[model samples]
Target: MKLLLLTALTMAAFAANSVLNRAAVGEAGMDALAFGVIRLASGAAALAVIVAWQRRGFAMGGVGRFVAVAGLLAYIFGFSVAYRGLDAGLGALLLFGVVQVTMFGGAVMAREAVPLARWVGAAVALAGLVWLLWPRGAVKMPVGGAVAMCIAGLGWGVYSLQGRLESDATQATAMNFMLAAPVAAVVWFLWGAEGAVTGVGLALAVVSGVITSGLGYALWYAILPTLGAARAGVAQLSVPVIAMAGGMVFLGEPVTGRFVGAAVLVIAGVLISMLGAQVWAGRVGFTKSSSGS
Candidate 1:
């Protein structure tokens, strides 16, 4: 129950990130590169404070530190830039779908014994994403935006995989954000920070960085031990649905039948992926115990 609560909170934070980014970049006229840089810097500061409060000194070197930092930068910059041309809903669908696929592939490469049910669940979730995001009419999507979102998803997947190897969630996340902030700053300078930025946009970015991203990532790392790669990937399918619902509530977007249907399918897929393996394993153990007895 505790784990479930923590996971739910982490997913909510992830969903809130989409809303905040949309508000900052789309509504408040903030430059995507600037927003990304601010978010990384603010997140680093927030995590640093938390680490200081906890008396944990900075320790950044590890087995996958380089990969983690690179992945973090890719996700931050790609996500910010991709949203410039991509619809929020469509962008989220693409990002989550790619993240799931990347993580599943990584799990296979790492020789994790993923069961068949999880694979089917992933397919069902992808189908649901397609159903939700497929254009109904003559909507044209920018190829560059799609590619950027895909890269963002891939980066997030790799970051999540690296998190699974960390012993200290808060410390690791703090170090990653700290290291990535300077890189993001450099990218923002090179990427042309020439867009309008209001106070509201900066506030939104700060909230997203300090709360949704920093603390959210810490919670995610804490929960990763309980959820393996496939389950973790499937579980994140809820983020898009939550983000859509948040849009309806906060952004005044209308909820349609397609969204309702897709949300059901996605939720069902996550449940099946997470629980089916456990149930099957439990029954197998029971049968063996009975036979031995």
Candidate 2:
């Protein structure tokens, strides 16, 4: 029960990233690179305080640290770049599709046993995503935006997998922010001035950093041990749905029929992929034991 709650909260946090990013960059006319740098810098500062209070020193000792840093860079850059051309909902769907593919592919590469049910679920979800985002009559896509969304998906998938390899979530998250901050700053220095950076932009970055990205991620790390990979992935699939709903309610974005259908498919697919195997294994064990008894 605790794990379920934690996972749900984590998904909400992740979902907010999309909504907030859209609001900041799309509505406010803020530069994406500036937002990314400010968001990450604020998060890094906040985490630094927390880690210092806890007496944790920075450490990047092994391959995990390298992977974490790389994942962070990809996620930050991919996120900022993707929004340049993609609409919020469409971007979310695209990113989710890429994320699902990346993580599942990672699992296969790691030689983790794949169940047939999961494969089917993945296919179902991918098909749903395609339906939701594919350009229809009159809805021509910005190719650059689509490309950015795919990159973001790949980056986030790597980040999620890297979290599993970290010995300490808080520590790793803090270090990643600290390490990535410099990179973000450099990128911003190169490109930030091109876009007018307003008070609204900085405020959005701060809010995202302090609330959604920083503390949210720390909490996610804390719960990862309890939830494991399958449950975690399934839980994250809720994020895009939540973000879409939030957009409708708060941002006044139009809710469409296709989005609803896509949400249903993604949610159902995630549940099947994550929970089916465990339930099947449990039933099999129970039957064998009962027959022996």
Please name the candidate that would achieve the greatest lDDT relative to the true structure. Answer: 1
RMSD values, in order shown: 3.3, 3.8
How much is the lDDT of residue 202 in candidate 2?
80
Tens-digit lDDT track of model 2 for 140-237: 56898888778777877787777766667888889888888888788777863587677887898899997899988888777755554544554576
Candidate 1 lDDT (Cα, 0 to 1): 0.84
Candidate 2 achieves a global lDDT of 0.75
C-alpha TM-score for every candidate? 0.92, 0.86
Q: For each candidate, what is the lDDT?
A: 0.84, 0.75
Q: Give the TM-score of candidate 2.
A: 0.86
Which segments of model 1 are wrong by more than 4 Å?
139-141, 283-293
Question: Could you tell me which 10 consecutive residues in candidate 1 have the lowest summed lDDT?
Answer: 284-293
RMSD of 1: 3.3
Per-residue lDDT tens digits of candidate 1, residues 32-67?
778878888999999999999999888966658889
lDDT of 1 at 146: 94
